[model samples]
Target: MIPPVSAPDFLVKAGWPGAAIVPLAGDASFRRYFRVLDGGRRAVLMDAPPPHEDPRPFIAIAEHLVADGFAAPRILARDLDEGLVLIEDFGDDRLKEHVDAQPDNEMTVYSRAIDLLVDLHKLPAADLPPYDRAVYRREVGLVTEWYCPAIGLAVDEDAYNCAWDSVLPIVEQSASPIVTVLRDYHAENIMLIDQPEAYGLGLLDFQDALAGHPAYDLVSLLQDARRDVPPEIEAAMLARYKALASPPADFDAAYAVLGAQRNAKIIGIFTRLWKRDGKPRYLAYLPRMWGLLERDLAHPALAPVAEWFATNIPADKRHQALQEFALA
Candidate 1:
């Protein structure tokens, strides 16, 4: 509960001068956000304190997304040295809250989200780290290094690395056009902006954007780790995306590979959050994420990873220990 060190001074210097700043909910990152009210104007004050969080990538990516005609928040003012930025407030209508409150809008909102990806993927992934085999392996490795140990399962790092070594090639072989993978493009990060001339989806938490398989973001959208997107809706959206965008050869296989990779990484990440970070709420998502992981592992392309899971983690044992840890 450490208050953002520079937020107060930064806000005053930015002309808010003790404006009514209400704390907004933070995400998994170290960054904190506040809804700042100054007279009749309202903006979001982002506190991305340095050493732990950097504002440069968010700033650069925001500019890049805005330049590309996307709905990323406009950076009204910034102090990169202090890792703070005052950005356009897109209001409280996060796509998750919108769709959850009105289930009927799920289809329309999700369709438009997929459409945003279609438009976004048409452009190339510009200057960013490549989401290649090495990076992917390291990410999923969190499972072996932290999760397995936490669940009292011995991990052979060699075998775990070997399992991913077999799977990474499939993800890399996609013939589809690669685009900037917005690392997190789920319901929560998307904003519902109803305007005639808008991208319709206000993007957030894209500081970790990278150059990688186009299917990565799609998986993030459809197979969300935090929420359940109805199976029928997910299927239809996948079909719709394929129909509208001529995805490359082996798109389905590539999608499955990326899905498995991302889910496996999440499984490890959630466990670490509970055991090390003492964030028990994240543990609740483990069962849901396990289901998603199981679904992804069923894909033929992920057989190696699947075999590794079956041998190491039986279905009944998957989240049982983690659940107990959550209660404790």
Candidate 2:
């Protein structure tokens, strides 16, 4: 994708005239990123077109994270009307690629990530929206609304809502302290930066952050949809966080609930990206998401939702069905 028409002027105003703008990446959203190079200096230009996207929340959250000593990209300049922002470049090393290249270092890197979250949870939550029952219901409802229809299954929508209603209160009453939930805190969004002070990880894609249960972000990391985090590593990371943070007895249950909730939302989202957004690449990840969701459903805390799934979606219609659909 070409840079937005206003990008050159914005870069010039930001003091980087005649910089080379190269496409960096585009995510599941309308936002696109480009790398800006001028002489020896480099920065990233975020193009979040308005009407369908906004950069204000990203700007606010980035500032908050930087001020708190977290390694969020520092915003250099912005134009709200055009939805453009020039921000610091965290370079090319993503935690996902790093772990994939050096499997032996997975434990060490994950320990550092867990420690970062432990420290992060100690701070006061940012003044953001709460991840409450309404948000949880809406997110989890995506499975019923999008995925089920796409797979040609007419589920009991009311029963699905009721199943979630029974178990969401468990998450709300979790003993862990509430803090900023970087709703998409996974390996791909984490940059392996060179700064030791920033714990070697630079945060990204946290604009949708909310004040919610601590387990939410942890679940996002260990139960990643795009990558496979071995069950042993997931267990070790959980132990590491619990030892560092001393969260209450229900932390495990909270993790399971949030895992199921998040995975369910992702399955629906991937389907929607294909059906509504015409982006079929995301469908490749559906099987992995279903696997994680099934594991989460096995937890005793998820019995209500588990029963709902067992009754509505037979075993053949879960991951296997998605695989067949994708191949077709």
Candidate 3:
């Protein structure tokens, strides 16, 4: 991947002259990150090139998180016109790898993450766009818009949306307080940093933060699209959050609704990444996503959505169908 042409000058202006820029990572977006090494000091340079992306949201959210005593990366410098920003590096100890290596510490680490969310929800949400029903419908529509067509299944789009319409209101009308929902709060996006202020967790990829139901981020964490959070751990963590937050009695239902919604969105997105963007690596996660979606669909709150899946994308047409397509 090519680094931004203006990155060098931006870094130099930000006081990191002649820093060695090393490729770090890229997500499912138009952004790329690099580690800028200047002698003994190191920082991350975000290259969110213009027209397609704007780094303002990330900068604003990062500043908000830091100001609220959270462990989001500190913004060292920025050039909004070029869509480049120099921010603090939280190191490479991502929660996903950390847990994968030491399975025994999973509960302890996840418990801390849940506690962080509980604390974060207590604070007033940042000025951000609401994760309203329109957003939900647009996101969930990705499955039908991308996945179904990719697999050559002409689904009944009307019925599919009808199912979602029946349940979207439940989450939107949740009794729990609306809070800043870090749209991608999974293990991969979290760094196991040494900062106590963030309860040893360094947040990342929160540029798409939104004011939504408290359960959305929790669902994102427990029902991770990229990793398997053990069933027991998932249950325990859900219980732990309930005990700490004392959310509404229907919180479990809200969790299930959001979980199903997010999983469906990921399925469509991963497919689009493969078909439209020519990035097929994301296809490998289809089975895991389907598994999580099935679990969420089993919840009584998702009756309509579950029925839609059963009738339209039946058992054989789910992940198995996608696997066959991949092999073909």
Candidate 4:
């Protein structure tokens, strides 16, 4: 919760004075942000819910990304005491909105955007924490537990075992050292705005960036929340990434595993979001996204686990649950 600390008081505390403050937009998180207007300069103020939201990691990663030449907004002042940050405003324009209005230019923008991943993944992540086996397994468990309950598909023991068994091995075999996995590296998080470099992707909503595989972020981008990314574009991005990063020949297999894991978690998340958060609009995206998960499973890489999803989880039931919304 942002205290009643006046914008003037914040400016005074930060040693910058006389700035007109305006509220910025925020999403479904404990954090609230405001875009401050000071003279001709602008900055963003972040108010994170204390106790539940920690500013330390957000500040730490912000510093690292800025130092690495990624266009993360500069952190001007972070009041750890109040869970507030007076940071540079990266503008409000996101890539999803940009390309949605101008579909003809998607490939051009995305090709440049995909290149940014190369910059992020090439760095050493020794300083970052791990998105290790424990977290990975727990994330998958959410799908079976939360998402399945919405449609009443309690995955049997064998079915549950099948998913983890196939996915766990691929994750373990990835052997790729951990890097800053921007957990939700989608178009909405990226600002497609004016910059000296054409690829100056303005990043927002990155507080959840973790230490994990490069493949994880890639999956996040290609399997985006707001749009159905074309298959050719996805493959092209992967090919471009592989050419530069020199990931193993089986990186695609790892990507398939990560994609399945991520999409499953999202299916559960959309279900939970609607049922728990009172945000039912997300439910509209399930049909296309479910089909996406189904298509991903067709890959031989995901064959072992696909049967569990198909056998234990019937599509007819998924469609039936979906019907609950249409009639509403």
lDDT of 1 by residue, 172-234 (tens): 876787689998999999988865355577999999999998999999999998889999999
Clashing pairs in 1: none
Question: Candidate 2: misplaced stretches above 4 Å?
Answer: none
Query: lDDT, candidate 1, residue 38?
Result: 83
| Tens digits of lDDT, candidate 3, 36-110 | 998889999999988989999999999999999999999999999999999999999999999999999999999
Better of 3 and 4 by TM-score: 3
> Which is the leading candidate under lDDT?
2
| Model 4 lDDT on a 0 to 1 scale | 0.76
- The lDDT per prediction is 0.86, 0.93, 0.92, 0.76
Off by over 4 Å in 1: 1-5
- Please provide TM-scores, in order, for all candidate models, with all chains considered together: 0.96, 0.98, 0.98, 0.90
lDDT of 3: 0.92
Error of 2 at 94 (Å): 0.1
Native-vs-model 1 lDDT? Answer: 0.86
Q: lDDT per residue, candidate 4, 1-328, as tens digits?
A: 3333655677778876876666666566667777677677788888875786877777887788878878777889877877878887878678888888898988888877778888788887637667777777777676776777776566685567566676667766776656789888898889876664637687777777777788989999998866888888888888888887888766777888888888877877777777777777777777766777787788888887788878877877663465374346
